[model samples]
Target: MAFPRVSILPLLLLLLITPFSSSLSLSDTITKDSLYQLCSQPTIRKHFCIIWLTNDPTTFTLNFYGLLGLVIQKTQLYGYKNLAMMKSLVRTTTDPMLKIPYGSCVTYYESAIKSMEEAIKFAILKKYELTSEAAGKAFSSINSCEADLAGRNTVPSDVPLRNIRFKRMCNIVRVFSDVLTAKNY
Candidate 1:
């Protein structure tokens, strides 16, 4: 009985690709888990970190820089939303004192949003130090707004609490930026 000849080229190619493919998949799993672990580090809201980081399908493939960009964008969106809410409150409020605080809160949110935008731009430019600084500014603005409201005991209902949560998210981003810069990741 005679057997048909099998091309050695196909077998050789399979042998060459198998290890690389397996390693690639293994690396992906490792990255995903490690990224999740990293998110849990500084943020008090572990669930929020996990959900926010994992909600986007593209997040699993993102490096630290890309994750920082995503955080900046989300924080900016939160700031804008809070700004609009403050504006609405200011418009509808009857108390002059409330108007002053609301107006100030609006300005703070706007400033935070701007800083977040700057952070995103810096991240895109691969300037991690600038990105981290901008993010810190954004975080400070959020905290300032919350502090101002709290000092006066006139927080816009849930705005202070929301700001605290947003600050935590920004904190996570900022910490990652610092770590990545320090370690040259």
Candidate 2:
């Protein structure tokens, strides 16, 4: 059987566009997977990163600024939860040293939540540099709180492990911000 004659112009256009379109789609998929992998890097909590980063479809579409907003939101949520637990400890603990450090931890987590709020606003405004700096400070504050608890020999068994999740989330956002900023994306 013979095929009917086709216009070469349309065929040429299709040939030209097909590879470009396919490659673009493929790259997007690769980028999404890379994000999941980057989020689950050795320094971070792999399972936690994988679960959170992959839970929503929008997470894959976010630019660095948008990603920063998500990170800030998560940080605030975690900080608040941890703060409440610390407050409970402060209220219940009989040991003076434990009470003081737990109280201090509550204060630090509050500051972190405030800083993360700032980071979220900056990210929303597309001010990634400000967002990065704010997030970095927030991350540092949590680290400082953990350090204070350790120094006082009042560190909760869960605080260090919990901080690892915070570190990973903040660090991933920082990495994305750095790449986008440096590339002027």
Candidate 3:
């Protein structure tokens, strides 16, 4: 005796479409992972640097304050006695290449977590103010991205991962430039 055939159309469709899923695609063209992979390829870094300098033509300006905060919080995170003793954010250049020793990664990680959380809030709010769908998606994605960044096993900024961080950095600067330049600033 043979068993009756059952309708498996839905399962077949799902399986057929699984290979073409849009789960990882970005809005326009490529995923952030693809972009980062492109960024990581040999000569792509040079191309990115060239494009960054030519297009936006600015340093990581928003992080300027955050870098200052990190410098100021050095002693708190490091248990050193002279971090806040500096004259100002700009004056703390005594050691241009001092590296934090081992055993303090977690402390710096926590400090960065707190600081980056605030920056994400600020950036998200700014994006919300733009009143555009693109901005909203970008900002929402940023919230998730930053959350992932904070959840890393190591300090996010130094983590050797491939993702949207570089692209988003360039986007922030480029978009901000577009805003300022459009407004005659």
TM per prediction = 0.75, 0.70, 0.22
lDDT of 2 by residue, 1-185 (tens): 99998779987687556532132221243356556545543445667777877776777777544555676787778778887887888898877878777778788888877887887777677666777787787788888777767765546678777766676677655555454454444
- In terms of lDDT, the poorest run of 10 residues in model 2 is 19-28
| Model 3 regions more than 4 Å off | 1-100, 127-185
Candidate with the greatest TM-score versus the true structure: 1
User: Tens-digit lDDT track for model 3 on 42-153?
Assistant: 3234455334333432322323223222222321232121112211211433333212212133233334334434444543454322312332343344344345445434
Error (Å) of candidate 3 at residue 53 is 21
lDDT of 1 by residue, 20-95 (tens): 3232222233266656556655544677777877777767676555666777787777777778888998899876
Model 1 local distance difference test score: 0.72
Clashing pairs for predicted structure model 1, backbone only: none
Better of 1 and 2 by TM-score: 1
